[model samples]
Target: MDWERFARQMATMAHDLLEQDSVVGTLERIVRSATELVHGCDAAGILLMDGGRVRTLAATEPMVDASDRLQERLQEGPCFDAARLRDGERVYRIENMTVLQQRWPAYAPSARELGIGSMMGFLLFTENENLGALNLYSRLPGRFTETSETAAWVLASHAAVALSSARSHAQMTESVATRHVIGEAMGILMAGHHIAEDTAFNMLRRHSQDRNVKLREVAREVVELGALPRPEQPSRQ
Candidate 1:
């Protein structure tokens, strides 16, 4: 392996990751990088556990999605375990997907049928939390080596940090936007009802609870409609 060339490519990928403006963009870039930088990786994807259900993201090809679905259905696979963060295990590899194994008897044959000859999974994690798993797939047996794993580990490290940053930025942006919209709604209510700011906020909060709606949604209704919607009164018998 050309160590110097690999290092330069990794440097470029790290820069590109941070340049992504959105979480989705960052994920897409990460998967693409896996296919490009990870030796023998023909397909790649990110698998996230949402309430114990698998959510496949940024799949590089149809094979990746198919493999993730197989793992989700069987409830056992390297990627599944990686995303679950079982026992602090950070990496898993399968050099021969065609062979039935005790670790994943159901997944091995199904994955082979899906044209996967080898596989690798790295848990994407930062100091604060575990994000998910970055999965790599190859169609040829024994495609991955120690060098491939090393390169993939480096990529996963950068990917985790980039993913966390993107999510944080997105959340911060959404929070700021929500506050601005809610403030506008409060101003509208204060003027329409001749109430103080605190009263307006309390009215919004109460309406949100009474209507079984989010506070942001309730505030948005006030802003869009120019006044808060009147609560429905009980009908006379």
Candidate 2:
């Protein structure tokens, strides 16, 4: 390994990932970089899971998209396992997909049929959360070397931090927007009903609970229509 060149490349990759402005962009770049920067990786994708459902945020090829969908449908594969990583396990490597039929019964056969010969998946995680997996695919069996794994792991580490930061930024932006809408709704209610701030907030809260909706949604309605949606109460028999 060229330690000096590797260090320079790692620094460059970290800078590029951190500078990404959106989660989607960051994910796209991760997969794109995987194919470009990782040895023997012919295609790549980012598989994000929300509970049991999986979505491919980005991929280098249509084959990768199809592969992820198969994994989602079967609920079995290295990518799925990597996303829901067990304790002390952060990466999964299928050195020869053609021979691992039993390990991923449903996914392996189909993946092999699709010409995927090997796979490597790394969990995208923070200290508190498991975000997903960064998956690499190769069309030749046993294509990934120890060096390839080490380099890809380093990239995945940087990607996880960048992904977490992107999501945090997005959540903060949404939170600020929600607060603005809620404030506007509160102002409307206070002006229309001549109520105090606490009273207006209580009204919104009560409506949100009664409608079985989120506080943000209730606030959004008030902001758009300038009125609360009050469902009719049932009469006592």
Candidate 3:
């Protein structure tokens, strides 16, 4: 298979998904595109790292999520190993789960019971960070060959970049919102105290230190309370 053509198609799909207004819509598109790109694969799934645990970002079938959850629970499998190692562009394929039992004794029987005869997993990374894995499961042995693995890798890399962009956008949006809230709180403090802006800021800092609270939490309470308590006066000498 010519990877150039596959790359072009995956890029187009990713671009279209990125244009969508919601992350859920984008993930749905990613899994659908991935399943179409790989041959002999009955299902496809994308795993994304969230707070140190991998979650099912999207999947072509519910069974795929179950299989992934098993791996997540077992904490040992091709996908987990690939992500931990940051093996971008790497593919691991096993012909039978029973043979894999020796290496992954916990994962093999459950995977086989789930009707997974062969498995191929591709690691997706962004720059230095390991994002997660794109997995393809097949019910027939020797289902994924070298050519299929390469095609899947091309699709997975583009998907990884798109997913990373979405996550970055979400973080930036949250940060801006937090800043807005803090600014509003500061304005409230300045207006209520009839004090200079710098003084109001210092009061907030002092209160945060004295109360053992976060600056943002203090700001939130000040905004809600509408007036801060008077600071205690030091005793006269």
The candidate that wins on TM-score is 1
What lDDT does each candidate get? 0.90, 0.87, 0.75
Clashing pairs in 2: none
Candidate 3: residue pairs that collide: none
Considering TM-score, where higher is better, how would the candidates rank from best to worst? 1, 2, 3
Residue 183 alpha-carbon offset, candidate 1, angstroms: 0.4
Clashes of each: 0, 0, 0
Ten contiguous residues minimizing lDDT sum, candidate 1: 124-133
Candidate 1 regions exceeding 4 Å error are: 126-131, 232-237
Per-residue lDDT tens digits for candidate 2, residues 21-117, read 8888888888888887788999999887777788888898899989888888888888888888755589888888778466777888889988999
**TM-score for each predicted model, relative to the true structure:** 0.94, 0.88, 0.77
Point out the worst 10-residue segment of candidate 3 by lDDT: 80-89
Q: TM-score of predicted model 3?
A: 0.77
lDDT of 1 at 140: 97
Query: How many angstroms is residue 8 displaced in model 1 relative to the true structure, after the best TM-score fit?
Result: 1.4
Native RMSD of candidate 1 (Å): 2.1
- Cα misplacement distance, residue 181 of candidate 2 (Å): 0.8
**Model 2 accuracy (lDDT, Cα):** 0.87
